[model samples]
Target: MRILVVEDNLTLASGIERLLKQSGYAVDCVHDGLSAEAVVSTEAFDVVILDLNLPELDGLSVLRSIRDRKLDSAVLILTAKDAPADRIRGLDLGADDYLTKPFDVGELEARVRALIRRKSGARSPLVSFGALTFDLNARTLTSEQGIVDVPARELSVLELLFSRSGKVVHKHVIIESLSAFDDDLTPNAVEQYVSRLRRKLIPYDVTINTARGIGYYLSKASA
Candidate 1:
């Protein structure tokens, strides 16, 4: 899943980004509300970790903009303000959930997972294609043969592709999603990841097809 963290605190923002990455989620971050608003309207995100206090535009205004656009991404308010009134205002503005500051990493992860599950209408992280099944939480790809261990990088590629099963996903989109602030992942590297994943998934009739000069997308081969 892709997440956008709108936190003004640089140190805290970096920590959240690193934490979510280690948990196998794609993350992008902005340390202000204006950037967050712009990014939210442009990019596709599964969740937005919003902070109430921000520059240019406060988190509440950003949250309202997200709802106004009718964007389906889940919004989780993360702020130092824990007052009952603050929480109610955030919820009333269409925030899917709320998290107070100084929270546990475990609970944060659980809440994020819950939001994802709620959005996907799935009780678990498993997404299926024919005989294949991918567990987003475990980062595992499997079938009736049992567990299928995919290379970590390739798994990241598959994660983006699988989620966009029918749509034509551009190569740049995959690169941006998987890359960290300083991590270097070129289009060629993304192609290599796709190539390897395609080979591994051939047995299951899951094909990653390239749209020459554009990008790659996923499709199930007919028997």
Candidate 2:
């Protein structure tokens, strides 16, 4: 999944970015609200971690702009503002969730996962397809044999496919979702990851099917 971190605090932003990336998410960081607005307007992110007390423009304005455009990206407000009015205003402005300052990283991660699950309409953290089950919280895929050994990139590719198991996900979408702003993920690299994932999932009766000149989808291996 891809996430955008908008915080004026450099240390906090860097730490959040690092942690999310380590958790297998493609994360982009912007220090100002204007930069955040620009990036959100142009790029697609699964989740946006926003701070209300921002420079240039406030987070509420950015959130308003996002809602105005009817973008479906989930926004989680992370700020030191703990007043009831602040939280209510943020929710009214279309923020999906709120986290106050002095929060635990574990809770932050869990809230992010909850947003993802809600966005995907998944009832649980464990998503099952074919004979395989993927633990979104654990970021692992398993069959009856145990956890399938998958490279991080390949696992990310699988997660994207699983998110839309039967729908065609554009090749460009996969490339964008797997990469941060500074990441140089090419189409060729995406193909390699998909190829590896196909092989690794074969034993679980899972298949990654390609749409000619388009993208890919996940399905059961044909009898």
Candidate 3:
């Protein structure tokens, strides 16, 4: 999963970034609302952890901007306001979920996982493609033969491909999902990851079909 952490407090933002990264998410942190708005507009993020008391634009304005532009990324409001009215306001303005400050880390992680599942229309935690089974909760992949110890990047690419199985996923989407602002991810890098996954999935009757110059799709060979 990809996450954007927008918090003005350097300590809190760094802690959130580390926590999300430890939970196997590609994360980018912005200390101000304007930066967060600009990045969220251009880049694709699965979820945004937005703080209300931002430096430039404030969190409500930022959320409004995201909704106005029709960005589909899930927004979770993280603020110190624990009042009922504050929560209602955030939700009314298009926030998917709300977490009061000084929250539990485990709860935050669970919320993020839930949001990703809901956004992807994933009912169960396990995802199946051909003879391969991916345990979303455990973040593990297995085939009829045995386990597949795919690398982190390859695993992320496979997850995205599996989520949109049978569709041609554009390279740009994968790049954004896999890379953060500081990460050196490029088109060639995405190709390399897909190429590696293509060879790995062949054993499970799965195929990564290239759509010429367009992108790639996941297909199961007819038995």
Candidate 4:
């Protein structure tokens, strides 16, 4: 999954970025609200971790702009304001979830996962195909034999494919989801990750089928 963190505090932003990255998410961050607004307008993110007290634009305005554009990314409001009125205003403005600051990082991660599940219409964290099962919460893929050890990048690619399951995910979309503003991943790199995943999946009767020039999708091996 991809997430955008909009927090002016350099320390907090860096901490959140590192935590999410460790959790197998592609995360991009911006300190000011203007940059946050601009980033949201251009790129697609699975979730936005937005702080209300921001420089230049402020969080509510950023949230409003996001809603105005009708972007589908889940917006999670993270702020120090614990006022009931503040919470109501954010929700009324289309925020999907709210997390008060001085909160547990674990809870924040859980909320993000919940939002992703809600958006994808997935009731369970485990998504399976053939003999392979992907645990979203654990960020691991397991086969009939045992839990498969996958490199982070390849695991990310696998996550994208599983999220879409049967749909043909275009190459550019994979590129976007795998990359942040500073990290650039090429189409060839995507192929390499997919290639590695294919090898691992063969034993489980699962395949990552290429869509010719486009991208890939997950399918069960034919009997």
Candidate 5:
């Protein structure tokens, strides 16, 4: 999943970025709310980890702007504020959840998982497309043939594609979904990964097709 971490503290931002990256999420971090708002306005993310205290614009203002524009991505408030009123205010501003500083990383991850699950309308942790089944909780893929171990990046790509099956997903969209917002990974690198995935899906009759100048589309060939 792709997540935006909006924290002004350099240490906390870097730590969150590193942790989320290690957990197989494409993460983008900004030290100020202006940059955070800019990033959110231009790109799509599964979730936003927003801090209330920010430079240029406060987190509440950012959240208000997001709601004003009707952006539907989930927002999880991460801040030093521990008061019930502060938490209630964030919820009222449209945040999906809130976590205070010095929080458990495990619990934060669990809440993130729950938020994503609810957003995707998934009742179970497993995501299926055709004969292939992806265990989101376990980060594994299985099919009638056998269990196929997928790398983190490939698994993320598959998840994005499967989530919007049969639709044409722009190349840039795939790139952003698979790469960290701050990572220098080139757009061509995204093509390379998609090429690799296409080869792997051959046996399953699933195809990832390029639309030449348009983008990529995933489809299952009729048996």
Candidate 6:
């Protein structure tokens, strides 16, 4: 999964980024709220790890702006504020979960998994599409062919496609999902990732079909 970490504390932010990256997530870190807003406005992320205290915009305003714009990505408030009122306010402002500073990485991972699972309409971390099964918590993919370890972004792409199976997903949509606002990726990068994923999925009977001038569709192979 791709995540945006908006925290001003360099050490803490770097630690969070390192942990998330080690766990196979694509992470983008920004120190201030304006940058956070700019990034969210232009780029896509599966989740945003936002700190309540920030320079420029503040986390509440950032959360408000995100909701105002109707972006559906999950938001997790990671801040030093541990008071009950603060937690309630964050939730009321649209955060999906809250984790105070000095938190465990394992707990953070679990919350992230839960949020993604909920967004995908799955009660658990496991999501199934046709004969394929994806375990978001474990970061594993299984099919009749056997098990495969898919990268976080690739898995995210797969999940998005599977959710809209049989329908063409616009290239921009896919790009937004895999990128952060500050990323300098080219438009063709999405196509390249799709091509790479298609090669990996061939054995599982999953086809990613590209419409000439449109986008891509995911569907089962014909019998």
lDDT of each: 0.85, 0.90, 0.88, 0.91, 0.83, 0.82
Q: Which sequence of candidate numbers ranks them by lDDT, best first?
A: 4, 2, 3, 1, 5, 6
For model 1, how does the per-residue alpha-carbon lDDT over 1-223 read when each residue is reduced to its tens digit? 6789999899999999999988888788998889988987777788999999999999999999999999999999999999999999999999999999999988998898888767756666888887788776666888999988887778877776665657787888777667654568798898888888878987898888889988988888673
Kindly indicate the candidate among 1 and 4 with the higher lDDT.
Answer: 4
Off by over 4 Å in 3: 144-146
lDDT of 2 at 219: 86
Candidate 2 error regions (>4 Å): none
Error of 5 at 138 (Å): 3.0
- Model 1, global lDDT: 0.85
Q: In terms of lDDT, which candidate is stronger, 3 or 5? A: 3
Number of the top lDDT candidate = 4
Q: Model 2 over residues 1-55: C-alpha lDDT tens digits? A: 8999999999999999999999999999999989988998899999999999999
List ranges where model 4 is wrong by over 4 Å.
none
Backbone Cα, N, C clashes tallied per candidate: 0, 0, 0, 0, 0, 0
Poorest 10 consecutive residues of model 2 by lDDT?
Answer: 157-166
lDDT, candidate 3, 1-223, per-residue tens:
7899999999999999998887678999999989998998888899999999999889999999999999999999999999999999999999999999899998998888878878887888788889998877667889877789899889888887777766888887888888888898899998898888888877788878888888888888664
Per-candidate RMSD vs. true structure? Answer: 3.2, 1.1, 1.7, 1.1, 2.6, 2.7
Root mean square deviation (Cα) for candidate 5: 2.6
The whole-model C-alpha lDDT of candidate 6 against the native structure comes to 0.82
Could you tell me which 10 consecutive residues in candidate 3 have the lowest summed lDDT? 158-167
Q: Which residue pairs come into collision in candidate 3?
A: none
TM-score of each: 0.78, 0.96, 0.92, 0.96, 0.84, 0.83
Q: At residue 186, what lDDT does model 3 achieve?
A: 90
Identify the superior model by lDDT, candidate 2 or candidate 3: 2
